[model samples]
Target: MTPDLADGGAASAAPSPAAAERAARAPLMSVRNVTKVFGRDVVALRGMSLDVRQGDFISLLGPSGCGKSTALRLIAGLSNPTSGRIEWAGGGRTDADLGVVFQEPTLMPWATVAKNVWLPMRLRGKSFASCRADIEDALETVGLKGFEGAYPRELSGGMKMRVSIARAMVTRPKMILMDEPFAALDEITRFKLNNDLLAMRAKLNCTVIFVTHSVFESVFLSDRIVVMAARPGRVIHELNVDEPYPRAEIFRTSAEYAAQCRAASEALNEAMGGAGAGHE
Candidate 1:
């Protein structure tokens, strides 16, 4: 769970140097000086280095084609980086405990929501009887408790996404890699899911690496936002969000939030080669 915010709505005090050093040594997952090249001509990631601490909510924000999805794919072990190494805390290369959610729900249309959510566990040779309790709990956690028997064709986009999230959580993953999971939802649904996601994160305490193009979403959801450049995707800036979790709607309208959003926009603009130029 997120550390409780101290009084005055600031992040808790930084850990002691020794503790920080120890944490630096203990990465749930570390992308160490990684690089990915699509072909002889195109470079996707250029020596990107990031340490994802346990339970962190880090967002990679950039323009389209900035390698954000590529980064997630590498971390998911769906694709290998052309160069550099990814080290897990317990020391291994491939992904065994990670959960991934793509932009689309990718649910089997013929299956009930409960059955869809149970697919991951079923693939691991566990029976429905063995995971029935977990399935119910996961559905409830994602706010789809009563819709278990509903089919994908009967659910709206937001509801389908909720099912996708439930499936990702059912396995109790150590980390979740989400690639613009809410990009297709309507504004109201998007905001609702954003709030729900934060609440779920607080309760589950799983590390999240979310990819998004929305500056506001990144500012509202992230503990740290990594802005990346497009042409050979690389981290241009790392912005720390000091706001406490369970942030109120009032905080969204506050000057502090606006300032952070503006900073992120500026960083994005610069990454997109618009330094000193107006941003959209």
Candidate 2:
């Protein structure tokens, strides 16, 4: 069973000892020296490589125009890398085992939240009645239990994003790929969703590969932050966040967090050009 965090901020559930023991078993998904090039000279990715261990919360972070989204698309099989290969743990190329959330909600306007969340299963040929319990559970997980019957137009921006998350979770995917899933939300809503996402990750035990530009969000949510450089995106730095799960707001205010964020900011600055190029 997953350990639930206590109200006083104690980590009730550290990662399972068995999970720790199997840490090096093999990555659930592996991106091996992947590269993506557009016609003739435009390169999106350049020999990028990373390993996503089972149940890891990995984030791909970089400035605008960096290939963060392209990397995620390559993993999702939505776009093929021009060079290099992405292999699943035991060696496979299909994305049937993954779920993907785009930057936008992309929900069906006519479908109820429940129906929209049920789309993945339905596409897989699963019947609605057969997956009713799973749909309800997913909705509840995203804090949208009572709004399952509501349409997309009736929901607020945050609620719509929750619906998008619920849809991704309903499939019981082995891995989830998120491309700045919360970038469009307001600060308050984004923070709330960030906390909710951490809680959900602890409970679900699924691997996540998220793409974002926010250093603070990357530090708070990732087990490992992969910082990429622009123009033919390549890895410039990889930083491991050693903090425990269910991270608290206090950690956000601590010196350690600031230091790491500063390090990331520096790397990102250098990647963009130099220290004085952009506003940190």
Taking all chains together, each candidate's TM-score versus the true structure is 0.89, 0.89
Q: 1-280 in candidate 2: lDDT tens per residue?
A: 1111111012113464433543654578778889999899989889998888887888888988789988998888888989898888776744357887878898999999999998999998999999999999999999999997899999999999989988888887888889999999999999999999888877887889999999999988886778888876888777666576779778889876877677667666767767666534
**The best candidate in terms of lDDT:** 1
lDDT, residue 56, candidate 1? 78
Q: What C-alpha lDDT, on a 0 to 100 scale, does residue 26 get in candidate 2?
A: 56
Total clashing residue pairs per candidate? Answer: 0, 0
Query: Model 1's lDDT to the true fold?
Result: 0.83
lDDT of each: 0.83, 0.81
Q: In candidate 1, residue 57 scores what lDDT?
A: 85
Clashing pairs in 2: none
Any idea how many clashes model 2 has?
0
TM-score, candidate number 1 = 0.89
What's the true lDDT of residue 70 in model 2?
Answer: 89
